[model samples]
Target: MPWCSTARLLHLRSGAAQLDRLEKGTTGLGTADALLALDCSAERHHVGTFQVPGDVNDLDFPLPGVRLESTNVIEGDGANGVACITRITTGPGVTDYVTHEQECTYSTFGIHVGQGDRLAFFGEGQNISVHLSDCRNDVGRPGAEITIGLAVSPYRVLTIPKGVAHTLDGLGGVVTRDEPVW
Candidate 1:
């Protein structure tokens, strides 16, 4: 029988959001069990997914091979600092560790992760959830080079629009990074 695994989507409102083809392989790290994903929308600025093609050699993470940090970390209402919040890290790209908020473009954006350095897969063909275009280099295609996955936060789908230059701000939903996630 084909081991069918479903991904609990980060974008779903209700019901079981399962990645039909995704199965658990191995978990590299799991502390608080946060959400993570890779953005695959060619247009970018919008959340999407892209599979790791057999022909593809490089990873499409953000520019300079970013190191994602916890920006909009919110402590649970009842839980204080003691409450373990969101903890994120790249499983497959350990060696490709880039600084937090590193600047990168498609041609300029790429990260390196050893065979085991990347994020953990629940099983072969397992799909993880990502925020989708968590950071956009520009409104145009310059940002399209960046391919993303739910680097963390596997359960909750969050869309944070932290505008450019780290100075522009918007309303609603509590944006903390100033980096728009499309």
Candidate 2:
């Protein structure tokens, strides 16, 4: 069964306005919970799933031969704070793979990547809710949307394909590191 069946049923019975309020967190529901309460089961055509690897080498990359350094934390002896690092190594003929990081203070919506595929890895203790829509058709044309709730841990990766629109909720203080594959 889809994760948001009850939420979908509520949307069908209530209306989009209620869902909108839920999305905006005006309905007293937590932002992440509200996003997960949305109905997107019917529109998950291109939304990918989390790749939880038993070992770093077992990861399935969206693009072949793409290599990335696992998330590593370096502890300081006494005076310095810990540092986290994630590095991307491009393969042959692959010139550039830039990793970007964003720390969300609140729910952010309508994020779209038009150039290339994006691999997003969240920091420790991140509990995020994502709403993804595949907008591969002509501009302004609607496509399938999928809502995913994730408790992000180390070594987990989520792929967002180019031309897909996505939203992140309940990300206060959560840092999201994205590696773009071109």
Kindly report the root-mean-square deviation of model 1 from the true structure over all alpha carbons: 19.1
Candidate 2 on 1-182: residue-level lDDT in tens? 11232233222333678667767778664556446435333333443544333444234433222223344444457475344444453622232323224544333334322234344444455566666654443323234555656565545445565544556676665556565554
Segments in model 1 whose C-alpha atoms lie over 4 Å from true places: 1-44, 47-49, 54-57, 61-118, 133-182
The best candidate by TM-score is: 2
Candidate 1 lDDT over residue span 1-182, tens digit each: 11111112122222232222112323342211212222222333433344443333334344333333322235457544222224353332122222222221121111111121122111122333332222332343323222333322322222222211111111112212212121
Residue 83 in candidate 1 has what lDDT? 27
Lowest lDDT block of 10, candidate 1: 163-172
C-alpha lDDT (0 to 100) for residue 75 of candidate 1: 45
Error of 2 at 107 (Å): 6.4
Global lDDT of each candidate: 0.26, 0.46
